[model samples]
Target: MSDKTSEAKVHFRSNAKVHEVDLRIREANVRLCQLCLWRNRKGIGFHIAPSSSSLPVICMVESNSPASAGGLKICDAILAVNNKNISEANYQQATTIIKTALNTKGRVDLLVVEQKFYKELKKNDISMISSSAKILVTPHSMPADFFNFPKHQPRTCDIHVNQDNKTFGFEVVSGDDNIGIYIQEVAPDSAASNAGLRKSDRIIEINGTYIEQDSNMNYQHYLWIAQASVYVDIGDDKSKLEATKLFEFVLYENPLHDNARLNLAILHFNPSHVHALETCAIVGLQMNHPTEAFIDLNQVLHFQPSSAPLLANRSVIQQFLDDNRNQSC
Candidate 1:
């Protein structure tokens, strides 16, 4: 038979929960492979050895053999083959599964756990070659709300200010031709500095009205505009920080209506902020804005092309966009 036909003959089976096992392996930074092994009538292609507990382990893989090409490594624990759970079976039973698979098909599928997981199991005093099965927790058994609950919410705080307070100890500048207001400076003892309001915080709203950049307004008017709206910043050093702190406290407690998206955009302003880009892309996907998500992910991939997680996320977004386009047609 041709190499392709011969390779297709081998089919291996695994007893371990594929997703759970794959997750653990990935967490452990181990590569997992589905091997297709083929043997002639004389069984010259592959060889297996029994471990101390009489369970099968990969002892040797021939160079250029089907096993080697399939990424079977030395000392890999044989978990199952062709639906047979070798962990609970004797050497003969395991070999029988391999032999039966080879006879029925031209090749057999071998499912083996990588060495790292085996070492971990051994380090924990668990027998690596034992016939006892390890029971894994299934997702269906978890609480119904386990995946539905939000893990975190925006933190809020309130700051009280006396009427004597004035200057908040910060300078505000219109961003990019007076399009939006941003914190330009925080004085050393200013209220803004004390309130955790970082420089470059884009002011989205004042009191209840959202601040808009108006080229017609002068910078001084913008500064004095919010004076009567519960907080004002003056030239005094003593109350500057206090008023600024109160303003920031109120702002943090009541984020803008589109705070999530705004926060992500602000974070991505730093070019090397990969996590920010990743979060932006994820939030975009969640909001059904695949185009936005793709833009963020593409920018990230340009920085780290080999990032597997980023590539996977991009693929998902691409698939979603493709599916949506197809449905619209």
Candidate 2:
């Protein structure tokens, strides 16, 4: 028994060493890129979302931005900025770190796990999605039943305001051809702003009733038809030509789903809107995205350091995560 135990211990130690070496090699392979952005002028021009327990992901990289020029891509996990560890930082903290690095040095060094590697990690585990890739709005597998529905239901969010004014500080405009209401502005320090309302957010519904449009056809119908058309392989040349034509009509013309985009947008916004973060965390938990929930909870704790409820909720999430890890092992 003693000999077997000793052998097992030796095997464990060897495995640990191998893991450490692999990690070091992976880190070394991650391209160390640099970018210079004017201080307080224009941002690095990328948006980030919180991961479950690892680095925040690059959700959006603007075209022609410093981050874009620096070879940053969507779904990249930002490992560090200027040697400052961001692996465990929340979205706000990661952005702040990058901004500070840019302000102080006029240039920032980023260590990132590129999208390809991140996708590989995701394939190994579902929880890895939070750490390795941006949350996609659409599912990889589209259900055939989805085609039966004329349109998806609009999502409504109730945000509590603890201020004197009851107004949600946002302006709306009719979408092109009066399709839906589009958020035109979100006033800073207002309830709407705190609720994570953004400019250009299309409001499909308010309270419960769908926003009516003058157009008889729903925009989403066109989008749905377009997506469904891709699978119309009738094994005939004429049918294939028709499918191609249908695809052309819907290509580059899909109306964004309000729910998924809103969830992502709110979760990614900086300056950490406590109410929005709390709501987002609840949504994340409901969606089985505990990593996203944990990230939001951590961000809220940063603002409300002494809130018992937040701390308790975070403890629950942590426990759940621990349980998940143990089960996975």
Candidate 3:
């Protein structure tokens, strides 16, 4: 029974786009929408209706609250909460996720696919979750060409290394105990292929642990960076001070180094890194750092938009930016 249920979930997920094809409606008739909500004393201001009748729908969106403010409508089906696929979850399970995110993070990012014609999809024997229904942002999966790989451009990607249905078919050529590891080859249509791993992509850090790198000066930069990680890991004020200086030295050497900048940002508050990029951006904006806020916001927008963000609702993002920029001004 469990195996059959899991198989059903995968099928339902795969056929999400079938409605668009069968009905000949617009290709993006059911694109996912992310609603970022900030919790307040008044609550997030939305109610999820019983799904016994259908997929979970927003029964009511309180006026002038995070729900309405975040562009949630009257019937947006709750697809996922905090990137967890809940299409198969019950009402209690769904609400628990929302409550947890609000209680822990004080904010939540919801991926909903509320379509006007959504409720009618059952007539066509279709489900909501699709092949494109991604709750979490992942790495690009483009084929790697030899000439296309470059050293100067480094981007962060999250790969599900250990998964039941996925195979990690990439070869790690060489790695130093201190500098970094490199990807030598990736099999086609494999886990590494889906993760956009290229032949020349260097594996600098794994699960936040720095490893093996090149030049005497470069080696010095990495050494301090590693030491900073240790100091931060030690979780003491003196260690924080040492980490601060080490991270600062790394930034001084390479102004464009994002890890150094992110480390510095986290180190500015807590060295344990409990306050991550989003929190830092929030605090930065609150502290009147518009440049930092805008930079972080734009980076997030660019990375997470996917093809769905470019639809007719591009103004939603643009207006958001304009509004924030005006306030900062």
Candidate 4:
């Protein structure tokens, strides 16, 4: 049967020259480019910046390629772009400028103070993209009189809330490009989850206190101290010192504090507390109970139920279990 199947198979070869084959491939590639040209045309934009450090009112408009037809001259000192205060503009504020221009169709009006020529103009119309293209242009024309752009508003309620120490929880963590806390996970059957802590949350503050990066002190050390002192009525400075001493003098402490243990539970409950969880889980696993690591992942899934990462974490626990079985062999 195998011999008959092999005999039935057929193969063919083309004897075309390299140049002829190359031309055919090039033709195929051009078809793909033609199909995607419409998508490319739809994506067009530009940015603006403050003209000088000395002049608070000075501004500058930069033209981006293919979308440059909006009639904005290079070095045009803009007083305002899309009705925003130009003096407040900074590096992060540039994103606001691009978003505003793109959202309002291709129309961008600049309130400019032309520095060299010394002229101020309001409603200086500039089309954000090339006018020569035959593509359909959508007019911005917002509501009769809308207020300023909505996306610029400051965010509130990013921290997940909960009830109490055992049943309620929250966490603060390091963020990218900004000083803030991000909620990575919340546990079900826990206070944080019940209080509405969800996944993908970037917490700006906790208990009205901003989460600033303390350059003078290590955040992980702070976390251990805080967790250790949760239940103790002792002085803040004394409790914090004891917590640090407990971990630092690991061998000498002999027995850890009950307050520290409770704090560890709370930190475990809030998965957004990354540094503390990593510390405890590593110690627990090294001490021969991999289940501690599994519990941390469970807290992660409480907030992000659909996460593939949490699913893979379950597989890791199973591997550890398998290792234990093999060891007994």
Candidate 5:
């Protein structure tokens, strides 16, 4: 068995050769490519970045891994998975398709083209990928890396529980990034801070137990369904946090989903569908996480620039941050 707790990503990449890809085209200019990977419960060892308008492109492949053995290369634009055309799929959609196939089938067949070739086709306004090709070009909703990753990379913090304190001095919380739970509010001079657990740093595991990607979506979706999209008890802060994890997982499975985005935010128990950033700016502010509040407000403002209430809320969060900075100084 592989040395992995789950197939969920938080991992490695490497370099090999182009021999892993089965070339469908004869010319170097030919963009069509293919890769059939044998996957374990863990995952095919590779990372894909959204490129060329939301198309999943092979960005990293680990050495001695299924993807590397299968001949997947960086910049290979994924066209379809398991023979389904995803020429127009966003990063979330593509990931969902891939995850669904991997979970049910235990193997994945990918149809891809080199990034340069896809760009060439786009440059010339070629939608039809040759009459023989299986995938037809679709319009792009993802213009680029809409998922702006934080400046920091994932790091391991070796915080030993103090014998006296017996606490790591941090709280775990789920946020918009569907990756993992983050370390919230590290106490200075405590085990977590001494080990470098900064605010917003994702906690990948605890005591050697890896947190898998597959989490129950019941709190947000099932409850919403049971009530016919109405009347979910937002019981308490802990309950809301649990629902937040559900929202993250649901969003992970389908980024374009309105329910995961909107319902959780506007859960005044109303029936009408909603969608505006993650849960709410007020929720983040109430939790005393100004950065998150700002992000939520910023996301809403991007779509509803004239929303006065949202703008006012953003101003409040901004002022709070400024005051905090001055205090620290």
Candidate 6:
């Protein structure tokens, strides 16, 4: 039994050493490949120095993998993974070997290096090795979807306060993580929709500040600006902030249903905003008063006669009103 235990200890120690070496190499390759994927998506690439002291180049990426989608070609040498650098001495076999092992675990890391995209292979600064590194995957295959990826740009529009003094407009931003300000579908009769706000119009900013970049300012900065500018104005609620808190609670109850907060927020800032006028039209339509909706639609048309969507909506409302009038007549 003592002899058997001694043998098992030796084998375990040997395996541990091998795993350490393999892990180091695999880590480097994964970093390189990940960076390559990012560069491809962003239209940029990087350069690396090949030194004898560096880790061995890991398993070259096969073409047609996610890395290849990012333009990594076959047989590209991996140099790093996830920001960890690798050298020729330690990583050449580390990546694939690690990948094979990770297949059992369902995940693996890779670092890859390749000839500069479309450039001739170059010699290492020290050993003059022709660098054949390439990341064999694309951005979509990164372990984490958000790793090293660029975010979508914010969307903004021009609020024509006057012919020459237009101010930038944005949708009311929402959500945690400071990801973006989304103008969920504009309410048909809300101040925003009535003022020509369209669905999917990403609210980028009010006056050029990135309110979406910080969760704390989504309401205070951008929403406040939109309301103040009369683009969205409801009525002066001296305790509007408190009212909003209550509104948040109400919204939380439904969770998925659209809340009245957006419309109310705009109205709170600019009660006379034309968009608010359209909200009245929507209410009229819901109440079976097509004529009332037509009146509200006409009120907005008086402001923006050339708005096509509004015109279309108005035409539909007008038809409804005319049919009702005929019935009444």
lDDT by residue for model 6 over 49-76, one digit each (tens)?
2334334421222222344334332324
- Counting only residues 3 or more apart in sequence or on different chains, how many pairs clash (N, Cα, C under 3 Å) in candidate 2? 1
- Write candidate 4's Cα lDDT for 54-84 as tens digits: 2223222211222223323333344444555
C-alpha-based local distance difference test score of model 5: 0.53
lDDT of 4: 0.41
User: Between candidates 2 and 3, which one is better according to lDDT?
Assistant: 2
lDDT of 5 by residue, 139-184 (tens): 1221122223234465667766422444457754343334345443
Model 5 earns a TM-score of: 0.29
lDDT computed for candidate 2: 0.58
lDDT of 3: 0.56
Encode model 2's per-residue lDDT on 169-220: one tens digit a residue.
6655444344665554567888776775544456655544465562324444
Off by over 4 Å in 4: 1-173, 177-179, 212-222, 233-329
TM-score each candidate.
Answer: 0.28, 0.31, 0.29, 0.22, 0.29, 0.22
Clash statistics: count for each candidate: 13, 1, 6, 2, 4, 57
Global lDDT of each candidate: 0.52, 0.58, 0.56, 0.41, 0.53, 0.45
Model 4, position 9, has a per-residue lDDT of: 56
Candidate 6 overall Cα lDDT vs. reference?
A: 0.45
Please tell me which model should have the higher TM-score, number 1 or number 4.
1
Strongest candidate by lDDT = 2
